[model samples]
Target: MKNHFLWITFLLILSLNACKSIQEKANDQFLSGQYQYAINSYSQILEEDPDNPEANLAIAESYRLSNRIEKAGPYYEKLAEEDPSFETLYRLGLSLKAQEKPEEAKAAFEKAKGFTQEEEYLAETQRQIEAINLAKGIDNYFPNHVLVNYKDLNTPGADYAPVTSENFIYFTSGRQASGLYPADGTPYTKLFRTRAEGIRVDVGSIQSLPEFQNEEGLNQAAIAISPDGNTIIYARGNSTSPKDIPETALFASYFRGAGFTQPIWMPVNEDETWWNSTPAFSPDGSELYFASNRPGGYGGIDLYKATKLANGDFGNAVNLGPNVNTPGNEMFPRPAADGKFFFSSDGHPGYGKLDLFVAENDASGKQVIKNLGENFNSPNDDFGIFFTEYPKTGFISSNREGGVGDDDIYFFEDKTPKPKIVNVLLNVYTKQRVAGEPDAVLEQARVVLYDSANKQTGGDFSNTNGRVRFTLKPDADFTIIASKSGYFSKSIPYTTVGKTPRPEDLVQEVTNITLDTTIVLDQLILEKSIVLENIYYDLDKADIRPDAAKELDKLVQILKDNPSIRIELSSHTDDRSSDQYNQDLSQRRAQSAVDYIVSQGIDPSRLVAKGYGESQLIIKNAQTEEEHQVNRRTEFKVIEIRE
Candidate 1:
């Protein structure tokens, strides 16, 4: 028994030493920036000790640094559940968000905010929540569109960044080639030119640009050509040295007689430490836009522009500022022919990864950034959009699923028809009543349409036919008012919220429809009183009842519509109560009605409340119950009207 106990002790010590050695190896790999190798080491450790917190965190970080955030999700989730540290929770939220699990990610971020007091972390957590909310509503802004990948141009490897000029399309690809990049064991990216008809590219006509080919182990991608097709700017990376960080720069090439000249590095790439790539030329060729990771940038990568100088060299690079950049990468800056700018960003509130965005100056000359939304973007990298001169059709690169390569070029066409204008015809009529006489039409009435903001949108005088027409936009609310001499103005509210042409009905370029509405104004006689219908109250109650409030709401609207009118609101009671009691109760009720009107934003100075008890009953010597009910009433009379 004693010998067995000693042997057990020795085995336990040896096991602990082995575990320590394995942990040290994993740590060494992680510190040296070999994230893939570190992941392998930490994963092995986890196989034996699944609850190892350090190993789990390390593996998650490794996967994130290697751009495999989806693979890191489970590990981060495990760490967050076990440790619940602010860093672990934040990282888990990011992983979940990138995987399009917004609700779960939001919970993680919310929990993280409670654990940290740092302002930066708190602000970032709030931004993430806002971004998730914004992403949820992105579908509303996108038009109906479809994307089709160019299968002929894609390969089993990576193929993306397509630019078209004339009938030929230039793009970058990393397919089966003679040269390979040692960094990731993939073929070095090279430029290829092919004949394209619309969105179909002929693979058999593919040819390499011999004049623009790079050395064996370097990468060349993201090419831009001028409008004249003579000058070309392409990104080149120095990937030959395995020990040093790769440096990318932009190079310019000029077309010569029957060939192109040797590429020359641009002066804008003077900083050796910064990366400059993804060049785009303005339509007039006066400015070149590119993405760089240089110092003094607002984010990881920002869009910059360099103007063409008189001496044929480019001027200083200018940052596009916060409107065009964010705390994340902003790349692939492309300007359309109509002065609109397009780019891709991960910092903005997007579905995930890099989503496409468009920026343009509004009517007030302020830059507005709008997301391209789900139709033009996906929960993956989408960038490098180029449009034709008309911009009706364009090509965009995306790394979404269902593609043949790592990154594939897609074609999109705008199929949404223009909005049609709606015509609203207003017919105004006036009716004069005098002791059962026939009502006569009063022409030449003024009709005006007021928008929801109370601004007069359109107005006109009624013609001989008592009709006035105006054009209106769909999905809006308006109030139509009609008035004539010696007539009480009538106001009616209308809305076109659901009056647009339905999707199934819009089968043509334009659909015209007219909506006809009639407004009838009542003739107003001097000293005439109008009894408000359905104004009633419970016994001994001074407060306005629900039914009574509804009846008074029309008066409130009238007071609001006619701002210069002053009126007296009077209350009356039946003969059952004593004269003093009835007078006092009616006065209180009248004051209650006036107070309610004042509460609805009407000016108190324009209203006067009065009581005329059983002394001024409408039915003289009432006998039936209905007559008594009619005697107890409320009425309004216009005392003064200001033009």
Candidate 2:
């Protein structure tokens, strides 16, 4: 009995020490601004002591600070139900406001205003109510656009901050399970790149940038590339600091010799006390824009600009001033090439926590601000606007509902009405001419397109249906060339220049007028005499003339189109010289034709040179000059078909 009593006393002392340890840890985490960790620690204490007011309050405050306001609402609601303090009611109202429940938030703020005695608290409560009222009617001023989530790049984590360079998109993502920060139990964000086709990004090609990844602690994000694409600026968080609240600083790196150099912190970075992030460079690379919470700002986070010095360093940072910055956070400043500034703000009247806004100088040189509207902004945080070369399409980052992650990137494009387009459909066929049969589809025939200037525009091989389609510009002329091996090439001219618009076409907004046409190519048969009309040697010389080369080019096209067919190029001569001399000259001429075809990318094995000097002639007893000219000619016959 004496030993049992001692064991019970030991257990009570251990329990008291555990409770004290948890309270100390929770308080330490809260002071360090690691709200997620603090919530975990405080919840552990509350599990054993359900009625502990300190633990309950710490958990609720942590959730609020961590931007998990929806989760914080229930804790604050329970406390208000039990004790109804002014502070609890005020915080609950802010939580409701962040969740976009303006009606409920206004009521809570009104009740809190009645209970608060401090002038500062009463003024803030009134401001909160007014802000909620403004938010209720802000949707009427938004622009029309379509928001599409980036299904390829997002995971069940934070994926945002997209910037485009050429054909690749550089973004930030905390998708890796490892390298998580202990403060929030969330993975550290790292810079990544993926290839994009137009506005569609290939997620499977996402690759981590090795020069910016931090294996030990927090890494870089919010990338901004220079106009030349040789330089990059980003925000690197200082997670290795021993202090409670870590800060992020701006850094720049140059892409040199096919790889990026080591990133160096910008000289404009203030001592670790200030947080600077979301860097954006002007199109000319003369100025750098970023967000900073440093001293002397208009509000929570103000936009600042630093001019690029002659020696490649930055000048003193200057705030954008009251016209742009406000009491709430202003971040993600993107300067478009078209002299427009875009940023996110909560201080301005918006639809949600952080709505995207555009600022541009009007004709009078006054800065005009406009909200992006309901299409782009949601009830959740939406920022990070990135525009492509095309003005109508761009990307935005949002943590809205139905996202694959906490903050997923979305692509937005303006699909307003535009002029109708026309389509040209080409059907390619091969004319076999097998005694009495019709033409058939020429599968895999090469179809090339050329504009009126004879410059090659685009080309594609015919599919199984022997068809190809091209969206030609209206009021233009084009030439379509179809060629196949063992066959003659054919060129067809198409023009939409003289086409008159139909009566119904004038009324439609957008329409695709399909103009269909068919082209036929004749096959080159074996043992057939096809005399080259202009292939004439000069004065008994074997040297080919320019006129002969023009005719032989047709043969080159035939060889290229019919790659599997072997042909014999034969040369015939009139009975004017000795048999041996005529035979030698004819052989040289035939070899010359074969050499020219080989130089034009046709395989040498596919061609054979033969000379029939006066032995095989079209005109047996040549008397007239025209008959003699026809006797001396060059012709090619399909000797063998490989397929």
Q: Indicate which candidate wins on lDDT.
A: 1
lDDT, residue 497, model 1: 74
TM-score to native of every candidate shown: 0.60, 0.60
lDDT, candidate 2, residue 599?
A: 78
lDDT of 1 at 505: 67
> Weakest 10 consecutive residues, lDDT, candidate 2?
1-10
Off by over 4 Å in 2: 1-18, 48-51, 79-87, 115-124, 139-142, 210-215, 238-245, 256-259, 361-365, 419-643
Q: What value does the lDDT take at residue 479 in candidate 1?
A: 87
| Pairs in clash, predicted candidate 1 | none
Give the alpha carbon lDDT tens digit for every residue of 518-589 in model 1.
776666655567899999999998899999999999999878767778899999999998999999999999
* lDDT for each residue of candidate 2 in 514-584, tens digit (9 for 90 to 100): 67677777776777766767888888788878888888988887666556678889999998888998898
